[model samples]
Target: MHPIALAILLTPLGLLLRLYAILPQGKPTKRGVRLVSEPCKLGMFLGSGGHTTEALTLLSSLDFARYSPRTYIVSCGDTLSAKKAVALESLKASEILAYSVITIPRARRVHQSLLTTPLTSMQSLATCVYHITLSPLITGVHFADVLLLNGPGTCVIVCIAVYINRFLGLHSPKLVYVESFARVRRLSLSGKILRFFVDRFVVQWPELAAADSKAEYRGWLV
Candidate 1:
């Protein structure tokens, strides 16, 4: 096989191996401090288009008190998400909540040149790894108690980073993945890949839930 083909075939296997290496082994300990008792920090990934809207809508339903010092991750050049995040911060000004928005290169930009896709992917991966591993220092909070994701390829890198942190016994954040509302019939590419690793996988459509036993239908988010 050509080198490119070999690399393509091995990529998924390599990712799985990395994930396994970082995951906790054996049964959980019965004794120790509970994560629930501590104040929660939130890390959210905001995708462009409909993804941003859906994510914000879901966030609005949650209690802000439980999740503070929130950090919003957006793709580089995604001004829309950054603007929406700013609006969200304004709403929380009355509550004195802390919020920050960080931008990382996108895994692949829309209508990107096919010849440059590989280069762009590597750049995006590097950016994701940097932000995910150094989030505590950059955002002034330990790992997020809950890492929320909706759609977009960018979430894949963030999830991997979170798991890597967990494997190193540095931080263990529950990854909550929500399928996009537009995906009524099936899971998106990102959703399909994340179902295995995310702590909570939720679908917006009943049909999707029925199709994938690993996912739960929690009604429309948009």
Candidate 2:
């Protein structure tokens, strides 16, 4: 292979390896600790249906004042989640709270063909790259300090985008994955995949936490 071609191929491979090598193992300690006085820019991915419901339920307990300037990443055409995000802010009724809703292409649609899935998934990833890197500049909101995700296919793409940002030595948020409340004994597919990638993997059930050494059981949030 030509030098430039080899460089291009090896660069990404090296980054991928680095990402895996740096992944949290056993238990994570360095990522979550921070000064309480510092305001955090929160990012959340809301999967439609039950995912959205549980995500909102988890968000309801947060102090809006602390997680100010939140960015709600939602799929295109999912007006309900967007509306609910707005409603959540409205419930706060605090003028200090600020948030933005970013709509990205869904990683996949229901009953989508396996052959076409990769193409659409790539498109979603491209959109994620744009939003993750440029949204802060465009909206004047800093990049997310912590990004929370549940069992959503689209969440994987967001995680990849964050990894890309980190690969480039840019500021990236600590990724946190929360398994759904309904999940008791087994891990959800998304949770299983994201377990190795997120900074924190939280399970609601004690059995799951015991099964996975990396998982933390923090009781049920929803």
Candidate 3:
């Protein structure tokens, strides 16, 4: 992983985690303390996909309703109404009192645009860790390319998710990647190199359903 990516990811998390330790205790503190633990600030990286619905459905199995995440990087493969996209996101954020999400009009590659794009202060993690401050989901799905399943944008997305987790005084997010075997392997050589630097890899549904039977899907994650 690039140092810029790590710096971007860690700087905020370290500061927030420190302050959270000293802040006045409240109802939020009555939650877990692990990185993205239940009742903690759980983070998610939204990649473009048709199975996004399934992904979200599977994520519902977790205790997000307990910890209450700060944001969901909503990325889509095609041009869809921002209103619809937002409505879809509202499913996850509707219950939270404080939340913010931004949709980018055009961003074919998440790595080049999203990571490089500047996030407003309101989008950053301030209220998630410190209840007195509350904020909205900072989301960006500017590109509708859906070009590569796990492209640089995915890398940037993961990097940003980790960064937000670290910045908002929360723990690193546990990623769950759900996609077809072909899509998973479509990643470019450089992209594969970057993916290697990520924390961990997980494949869901069809991608790994038959992984044990076939060698192709065995290392599909890396």
lDDT of 2 by residue, 1-222 (tens): 899999999999997788766666665547556688888989999998999999999999998888978999999999999999899889988686488899989999989998998999999999988877666557764578999999689899999898877766667788989999889999998899999888889999999999998899988889
Q: Per the 3 Å backbone cut-off, how many clashing residue pairs does candidate 2 have?
A: 0
Candidate 2 regions with alpha-carbon error over 4 angstroms: 1-13, 31-33, 135-141
> Candidate 1: RMSD over Cα atoms?
5.7
Candidate 3, 1-222: lDDT as tens digits: 999999999989977777555332322223334554334444443344533444344445545445443344444433342334355556655565533333322233444444544442223222222321222233322111111123324334434434444455443344323343345434434234433333333343344435422112334332
Q: What is the TM-score of candidate 1?
A: 0.80
State the lDDT of candidate 1 residue by residue for 1-222, as single tens digits: 999999999999987787686543333213446476566788899998889988988887766766787889899999999899888777755367577788888877889898997788778777766776675657765756778999888788788777767756676677889998889897899998988788778898999989877787877877
**Residue 84, candidate 3: alpha-carbon lDDT:** 40
- CA lDDT of each candidate? 0.79, 0.87, 0.39
TM-score of each: 0.80, 0.89, 0.40
Give me the displacement of residue 62 in model 3, in angstroms.
2.9
